[model samples]
Every structure is written in C-alpha cells, then in structure tokens.
Target: MLNGKVVAITGGFGQLGVAVVQGALAAGAKVAALDRAPAPAAASNLGDALALGGLDLAEPDVAARALDEVARKFGGLDALVNIAGTFRWEELEQGSVDTWDLLYRVNLRSAVSTSRAALPHLTRRGGGSIVNIGAGAAAARAAAGMGAYTASKAGVAKLTEALAAEVKDRGITVNAILPSTIDTPANRADMPKADFSRWVAPKSIADTILFLLSDSARDITGALIPVSGRV
Candidate 1:
C-alpha cells in the first residue's frame, strides 16, 4: 500500500518499532528506523530498511538532522511514525516531579520535534501522513499512579489534532492510535500475571499505522482511533 514511499519510524529498535518497520517494508516502503539505543545486530532482520540509532529525538536539532538524513537518503520522506515515548506508573504524591518532566520530554516533546522537522520534506512531496502512538488509557481516563504517563500521552493526542488542523491545507494528515496494554516483552515481564491475550499486539498496531499511511486513509486526519484488542 506504501509502494516506493519513504517512511521514518522513531524508537525503531524497540519491539513495536521493529514491527512497524517490517510491516512498512513489506508494504513496499523504504524505511528509516531511528532509535535511541545503539543499532542491534538483529537490525539486519529488517531487510534493507535504514537503521539510525542513538538518536535523541526530543532535541529539535537532533531530530532535524536525523530526519534530514532520512530525506536525503530516500530522495524524500512520505510518512512518519512517532513511536518514541516512555511510560512511568507513578502517583503524583509518590513520584518525583522529575518523573513528569522526563515523561513529557520523551513522550510528547519528541513527537513535536520530529514532526516539525519532517514537515518541509512532506510538504515538498505534496502530501504525507504522521501516525502517533498514544495510550488508550490516557485518552479515556487515567488510573491511579498513571498521572505522568497519561499526561504526557494526552499531550500527544492534542498534538495530533492541532498538527492535523495546521497541516490539513498542505495535504498532510496527522492521526494517532490509542492502544491499551500493548503485548510487548517489556509489558509481559512487568505484568507476568496479567492476561496477555487481552493486550494488543505490536504487529496489529503496526498494520493499523500502515493503513493510516496508505492512500486508503488519505482522507482520515485528526483521528484518534482506539485499538484496544480485548482489553
């Protein structure tokens, strides 16, 4: 569905990020996988997708340089998936104020920086899509100990709407996927007793993101689609 299009994914070394990269490549897109972690040897499994590691996407200059590199390498950029976010479960009273700051930078600011950097390239190509990974819990309601995380993700949801409206006239569409309890290794390790089957799979979310990037979803913008699986 993404034939010959260039797609860049942030947090590309993580489980979910890898799934998105593989899906996009399978759909005939050239992908640039950017992550804060060093490129793992297993990155070879991504076929020919470009792997750019050790990136601090929250920094505007860093994001700009990384995205500019992707555009230069791929001739231009068509879509971007902002999946570089961190989560922390902490009640406001028990958690340090630093936790809130950290989550805000990692979860919300990174998307803002990266999307801003990708705008020129996408506009130059006449149109593009941006898919942000938001938390379903955040969008619906925040539970106890989820203040910082939910607040950060809520910022992402708002960013999706504001950016979508800002770029609508430029043929750019921005949307977000709100997933509940993604079935990742980290989540499984963190909640061993939880019902894993109820959680959404990384591949499932990746497929949804690809659909948003495809022409089929060209008219869909500022949408916060919920992908909660059985959860």
Candidate 2:
C-alpha cells in the first residue's frame, strides 16, 4: 500500500536504515535516503531512489532545503522516517557533559529538525506519516549506564506525542517506535555475551515502520508502538 508514495528516511546508511530503505523500495515507494555518512557501495544501484550523504539533519534549515529538493525530484513527498540517532552507555557521574550534549544533538535534534522540515511537504499531500525510532530502554527505569542516551530518546517519545497533536488536523500523523536491543551487527559486537535471538530484527522493525507509513495506519498517530522481541 505505499505505492507511488514519496518517502524519505534519515540515517539511511545505517544497518537498520538500510533495511528500511530496501523495504520501502520493495513496497513500490519512491524513496530519498539521507545520512550523515555516505551510502554503501552496495546501495549504488537503487534504481530510481535518491541516496544522499553528509547532510546533517541537526540543521533545520539544511534539512528543509533537502526535503524541498526531495519533493522537487520525486514529484511530491508523503512520508518521513526519522531513524537517525546515536547510542551511548555511560553513568551520569562517569560521563562528561559532552556526552549529554552529543546525545541531544545527534538524537533529539536530528528528529526535531527533520520532522519540522518534512511536515509541510507531508501536509501538501493532504495527509502523511512520520515515524521515529525510540528505544524501549528509555521508557524503563534507567539502567546504570544509560542516562544520557535514555534522556535523549525520551525526548523523541515526547516529541512524537506533541507533534501528533499539533498536526492531527493537517492529516499528518506523527508516531514513534520503541525497540529494545535491535539485532544489528554493532549491537552484537557491543554486547557479545547477550542472546541475539531475543533482540528485535532490523527487518521486523522495518516492516512495522513501513506499515505505520501506509494508508492502513492513517488513523494511528501519537502512538509509541513497541517492537521489543521478548526483551
């Protein structure tokens, strides 16, 4: 059901973002994949989709220009997935203030800036969807070393709720997905002793995100859908 939709995904070069971009294309949507890092060589031939790199989503003005460019190139814009964010593990006392600052800039700022940029274009479509990636870890009582990261993702959850209320009348739906321990290679490396089977798969998360962006989920907004795989 996303056929003909022009969807944009931030953090498009990442493992999870790569899953999302490929899935969106498979579902017959025109896609614009944006990331601070360049696209992998394997993604060079994405048929007609746009894959751009080095575009910082933290800068609202730059994000607005890029989204406008996407609309111009893709004919129109329909959906955006703010999957760009960073993760850090550090206790409050052990962490430098810079860690907090870095987390906010990379996680919260990216989503806020890009969602603000994409809102008008989505509204121009009469209605559209915005899906954000939040961590389930953020909702639970803070783990010993997750203070900075959790706080930033908590901001994302709040942003989703508030923005959904703001744009409900405009036909734009804003929502966030909270996933616990995504089964990515990086996570596997970081937590080598953990059970990988319990972690959520990138493909599973991508499928859910795609569904949220489809017409079927048009009535769903401000929902923080959790995709934890028994974690």
Candidate 3:
C-alpha cells in the first residue's frame, strides 16, 4: 500500500517505531528512521530498506536539520510519523516543575517542532500525511499518578487538530492514534502479571498509521482514531 513512498518515522529505534519502519519497508516504502538514540541493530535487517539518523525533535533547529537531511537522502518526503514520546509516572504532589517540563519537551514540544519542520517539505511534495502517536489517557479524566504525562498528551491531541486545520487547504492530512496500552516487550516486562492479551500490538497500530498515510485516506484529517484493542 506504501510502495514508492518516502516515509519518515521519529523514534525509529523504539519497539513500536521499529515495527512501523519494518512494516513500511515491507510494504515497499523507502523509510528514514529517526531517533534520539544511535541507530539500532534493526538497520542490518533493513539493508537498503532503511536510512537511519539521530535527531533531537525538541530543538526546532535540530528538527529542521533532520527533516532537510531526510529529504536530501530520500529525494522527497511523503509521510511523517511522530512516534517519539516519554512516559512519566508521578503523582502531582511528587512531580516537580522539572518533571512537567521534561515531559512537555518530549511529548508536546517535540511534535510541534518536528511538524513545523516537516510542513514545507510536505508541501513541496504537493501534499503528505502526518500521523502522531497520542495516548488514550489524554482523553480520559486524569488519574492520580499521571498528571504530567496526561497533560502532555492532551497537548499533543490539540496540536494534531490545529495543525490538521492549518494544512487542510495545503493538501496535508494530520491525524493521531490514541492507544490505551501497547503490548510492547517493555510493557509486558513491566507488568508480567497483567493481562497482556488485551493490549494493542505495535504492528497493529502501525497498520492503522500506514492506512492514514495512503492515498485512500486523503479525506481523513484532524481525527483522533482510537486503537485500544480490547483494553
């Protein structure tokens, strides 16, 4: 479904990000994998299937540089998946301003900076797609120990909506996936006793993102689709 497309996936070294990259590559899209960490071992499997880069999406200039580098390397940019995020589990009483700021930088500002940087390149391509990874916790009422994380994701949701509106006329489609609990290895390890069967798989979410990026989803924008699985 993604053949001949050039796709940029942020947080490409992460479990979910890697799955998305692999899926896109399998579907025949040229992929650029960007993350804050150094390239991961998956690059070997990608061979010419992927290009990897280190990027700090919180810094606007760095984000711009990363986008420029991707465009230059890939020859063009068609889709951007903002999957980079940090999870902070802390109570309001225990969470300091620093904690809030840290989450804001990673979860909120990073998306904003990267999206801003990718806009022109997407426009140059005559239109592209942006899929943000959001959280279901953002839509639900706040939990006791997730104030900062929830707030940051709420910001992401709002940003997705606003950006979609801003770029609608330009032919860019911006959307978000609100996942409740992703069944990643880390999550399974963190909660070994919990029911992992109900959690959404990374590949499943990646498929939804691929669909949103496809030409068939041209009319879908400013929408936050839930991918909770059975959770």
Highest TM-score model number: 1
Please, what is the TM-score per model? 0.98, 0.97, 0.96
Q: Count the backbone clashes (under 3 Å) in each candidate.
A: 0, 0, 0
Please give, for residues 107-226, the per-residue lDDT of candidate 1 as tens digits. 999999999999999999999999999889887667899989999999999999999999999999999999999999899999999999999999999999999999999999999999
Model 2: number of backbone collisions: 0
Q: Which residue pairs clash within candidate 2?
A: none
lDDT tens per residue, model 2, 1-231 = 789999999998888888898899999999999999966565364445698888989999879988999999998899999999988888878679999999999999999999999988888889899999998988899979898999999999999999999999999999999999899999999999999999999999999999999989989999999999989
Candidate 3: tens digits of C-alpha lDDT, residues 125-224? 9999999988999999998888999999999999999999999999999999999899988898888998999999998999999999899999999999
Models ranked on TM-score: 1, 2, 3
Which regions of candidate 1 fall more than 4 Å away from where they truly are?
Answer: none
Question: 1 or 2: which has the higher lDDT?
Answer: 1
Report the alpha-carbon TM-score of model 3 versus the true structure: 0.96
RMSD of each: 0.9, 1.3, 1.3
RMSD of 2: 1.3
- Top-scoring candidate (lDDT): 1
- What local lDDT score does residue 173 receive in model 1, on the 0 to 100 scale? 99
Off by over 4 Å in 2: 42-48
Q: Which ten residues in a row have the lowest lDDT in candidate 1?
A: 39-48
